[model samples]
Target: MTAERPAVDPRWWGPPIGGVAFALAYPPVDLLPLALVGLWPFLWFLDKELENAPSGSWRGAFAGGYLFGLAQYGALLYWIAGLTGFSVMAVPAYVASVMVMAFNGALTAGGCALGRRFGIPVAVSFPLAWTGVEWLRSFGDLGFTWAVAGDVLANYPLLIQPAELGGVYLLSLWVVALSTAAWRLVRPRSDTPRTATAAMVVVVAAAVPAYGALRLDRLERQLEGWPTLRAAAIQPNVPQDMKWEEAFETEIHRRLSVLTLRVAPREPELVVWPESAVPSWLRYDPRTRALVPALAAQIEAPIFTGTNDADTLTGRSGREAGDYRVYNAAYLVRPDSIVSNRYAKQRLVPVAERVPFVPGMATGFFERLSAWTGQFSRGEEWTTWTVEGFEFGALICYESVFPSVSRALVLEGADFLLNITNDAWFGRTAAPYQHASHLSLRAVEHRVPFLRSANTGISGWVDPLGRWRERTPLYEPATVVADLPIPGGGTPYTRWGDWLPFACVLAWGGLALVGAARARTAPRGRGSVVASSTGR
Candidate 1:
């Protein structure tokens, strides 16, 4: 009898196209539904691959996964071009950044492929593998947790309360699980598939109502009445190119002073400026220091602004070394004595602020990329500054995305969170909106009010329930003044960080291993049969 030809495979096109579609769905735009459809092909591919392969082929999986990642990241982060002055320069950097992000995609694909080879169902393995990969991607040298799957629902606060339980990772897991489960049931092979899919649907459906009930209950509970304080977020609208120039320093100060005086009638208890509002070192500028105390006294509150600081000392080599530490630092200037609360930004943007691992062989490339560098020293500890009984944690620019960084501040006794950012680098792109959305999640996570003051607009206060009290227009010169209620108690997320996601990853890993072992010892004939039937 003639050997039967292997069944025609249909999964090869799914992942890459799905990844690309998902990328297109990301904000400051929304095409997520289409992206979901795109992902079906990739999911189908993995299902087929797993059924056919007795021993997982790492090489095939890696190649496919990497391509998918490349497409996904490339599409999503293409907006990074908004940061650079010229499109020529921006395009290359954008490409590089996307390439960096693709690393996560490759890992996710490979992990899923391996899991499937062990007979784990697509509904279980895809979500688990995705969760593990996302968690891993949040750390490491090129770590950037932006554009997370959970962030897709950022525009809708009501659906995002699950973040309080397992943080953003939980939401991501749910999205993946629901999508995969739906796919599995759409073309069911087993009699019980309907029941399994229905269960998944119920779980996902229940989360929405559960979250709504929790929000209603929380809102009904009376918040501890704190003194209503007015705050001014100064927007100087300094151009990115001129922001660092010596001539623009005086103009920036003038503009800020003008805006500060305009809001003085409202009598804001605190007047805040964006990160590095002052281009020069405060200590070196006697004129500026003379002006700060007067400004603080005039406002009858405190003036918190960003400035650079420097220190000089002799090194072990005996030659006097000038330690010019460029800080995305904040200063709290009071009338009596300037209680300087400086928070040097810990998480610097990779190439723009500080290059990672520059001490070794990468120094040459680092030096070349150091054209627009800010060699700022990272802060070692979280510090909460108190002004008139109100304690606030300060995050400068890019530090807002780091959940641990903000959570640490809350743990250290902060009543509210303050973020100072100069988003002129991103021009009029989705970066500012995307950056602003992170504050809402952080507020929900910590059950604390978040006050953001950005240079080029989108400055706002997010309440404990992820509600925006006030926000300014993007790329506009404006001020957002609002009264934000501070939550008295911390949420479960603030108390315990990443525990749920970590548990999920560990459980998935265990399952993957068990499946792998079973596949390893299966009869050769059975393995061949599975391989032939499932061949893609």
Candidate 2:
């Protein structure tokens, strides 16, 4: 009998085109439905390699996966180009980051290929492996979890309520599972019928939204007559280039003073300012330090704003009194107190604000290129400010993306959360919108209301149910005053954080081990049709 020829695979066109669908699912474009099926084409492409590639299948899988990744991130993070005014090197840095992050795709492809080499079906293996890689990508010092596949639904409060149960990982799991089922339905294999898969996917897809609707209803009822706090969020709309200039310091302070006075009629118990609201150090600069308390005294409310800070080491560790470590910090100024309470920023922006494990000289070079000093020191503890008996935690810019940070503050007696960000660096790009969306999820995840004050826009309040009470337009000098509700207790997500992702890690590890063992033991040319078939 003549040996059979392997099928021809056309891998070039499918994955890269499909990748754009994921890009559109995020902000600026935001066609969310595309997220559900965007990866289907890549999955199909991987299947082709498994069934037909003579050898070096993993090479083809990696290449295709990387291509898909390049396309996906290239489109999603094109806003990185907006940083060009700061540094020409920013373009290459963005590319390097995207290339590193694209391992997510490579891992997914490799995992799926291993699954096929064993006896695991596409429906079971694809979702499991994909979610595992996503969860993995969310960790480590360089973890970049922006625009996870499920974050597309962030605009829909009801659909994303389950995020409180499992964080974004659960939603990602749901998306992958549904996608796999839908693909199986569209292209039925001999063992699994199209109708069965379609019915299962439909039931799941319908049930999630139905559950979300119910949860939203329950939340509305539960939140009735909850405690409320009246607060003002200030968006200064200061230009990034001029913010750090000494020439504009007087003008900047004047604008802030005018805005604070503008909201006096609202009689906000607390006035929140955007990240890096003051270019100078509030604690160290004698003039600026005096001005803060003076403003708080004038406004008759505790003024909370982002500013640079430093802790003098003095004699500690044999350092001189003048030796100090600077921080990206939030300062609380009361009428009688000057810089009495402060929270140093814990999560600094990766490249712009921090460069991990680099020499001081090299770090300074990059910082100067981006118009910043060297990386800042990390905060040791979570800080909450109590204003007129209303307690809230401050999450500085870029810190809100980490779900753990917000939950920790909630668990530490924070009734609400305040996120201060200066997104002026991103210009009119999608970064600001995407950055603001994270706070909504954080609100739901911790069952606490969130107030965001962005320097150039997206300043608003998200209620306990993840609903936006008020959202300001981009680049507008605006003040949003609202009576934000405070939830009494934490949600399920608060009690259990990232449990689902941990379980997924375990499950994926077991599957990978089994697949490896099976691949080693199975005969060379005796592959089952179920293992090789793409169903379509």
Candidate 3:
């Protein structure tokens, strides 16, 4: 007699719960082996749950996927509440932001369900679908690409070098693949499963050390030609509530000027100020133009500061007037010439800066909410401005989270990554540290050095191998001046991005098709048979 199929216990929730718990303990203070093994439970859960399930169990798959996503995002971004003042008045805004994040969870669910139809293993399908969904979500009005899965691997520098070939998506693929393979080996099965699991192990074992060795070799080469330039970053600690107040505008400018001049003796080749360093609109103020140019002359190097601009045009009412538009722009100023290069922030913080819409919500409410002056236009493209012999791209505040935005700039011939942010709004929470972690991934992905200047903390530099060269203290007024060596050669990820994830998805789809065909032709009454053709 054939062995009876084992019953799925009510306790099956354990694996998913374990997975969720593991994801919560990230941005680790100390490296632990347990954290590396944390994702295995989730993969195991997916494998076991789907192993004998019906072919069209998309709903179950989607529900499971969504639950996992919700847990992951909710845990990681709980610090977002730190943005709200914790007053009774700020409760609505805090709750609203959490709800918006939950909505992004649905995308993860949808991707999983769609991939399941092809009979692909959750290990292969989950990462691919997740990567694809993230790529799609990053575009248009509803984009929020901050909490990507690969970000969990940011603390491990040695494991992240592969990003140069496939970007963060490739890292996500590797993570998922390994977790799934581990799950398969834990619950040994057929020869195909064993072979697949063994193959995955071989690939990872080979890849990890090869990447570590390559990074070590590259580090030696980079150090041999370290470029030293005196650079200064200005931090003007302005209170968030008083930032827009006319009374505090002068104080803001004075503080920035004082900071700039203090560092001028260092004779920096480039001096960078945080976003909106000058509180007043630059185009409207002649004094700003005159004074800034004079300061640039004193510094004897280009000074880049953030300010607003106004564009004059005829209104819809047929009256010619100047429309005041606020831009988070950067200006390159020198004594003889002021070269203005502006990159209006592409990604605005939701609710704090802009509001996202709910499907079927009233358009009138959205319109009314959007009538406020907080809205800013996104720049059409990225441009690299030259300073000395270097061409660096600028990412203002929230723009640093989106890799494609930075990648597009790199593709446009940017040599290094420069980010100017005001993390003062988030105060002394984990938000700034988390934000800094994301920047590290971008450096590894493009094989470029990243420099950041922030208002009230966490200003630093990241090397090509994703190492943090230097950083300022959190929630403090400080300047980080580093001699960063620019990397000329790009990695495989920069040359061919996201292809690895796409290939994994395609492979999963093909396997699912073959499994479906096999199941349809199999003899009946095999106890509702469901078998995965290949394993990890």
Task: Indicate whether candidate 2 or candidate 3 has the larger lDDT.
Answer: 2
The order of the candidates by lDDT, greatest first, is 2, 1, 3
Name the 10 consecutive residues with the lowest summed lDDT in model 3: 527-536
* TM-score of every candidate: 0.89, 0.91, 0.85
1-536 per-residue lDDT for model 1 (tens digits):
99986584346566678788876666667665753455666666565555546555656666667777877777767668665663345666687888877766677667766665655555676677777777777675566888777777666677677777777777778777767766666643533358867887778757765875778476647554544456778877888888878877778878888888888888787888888887677767887887877877877878888776655646799877654445557788886647476666777776666666563223355656665543555556677788667788888887787777788888898888888998887777677888888887777778777778888877878877777878888777788776767755677887888886687678778877776576567666754422433422
Give the Cα error of residue 418 in candidate 3, in Å.
0.6
Q: Candidate 3: give the clashing pairs.
A: 118-512, 164-493, 165-492, 165-493, 166-493
Residue-level lDDT of model 2, residues 451-470, one tens digit each, is: 88999998999998888889
Cα deviation of 523 in candidate 2 (Å)?
7.4
- Single out the weakest 10-residue window by summed lDDT for candidate 2: 527-536
Note the clash tally of each candidate: 4, 1, 5
Decoy 1 TM-score against native: 0.89
Of the candidates shown, which would achieve the greatest lDDT relative to the real structure? 2
Candidate closer to the true structure by TM-score (higher is better), 2 or 3: 2
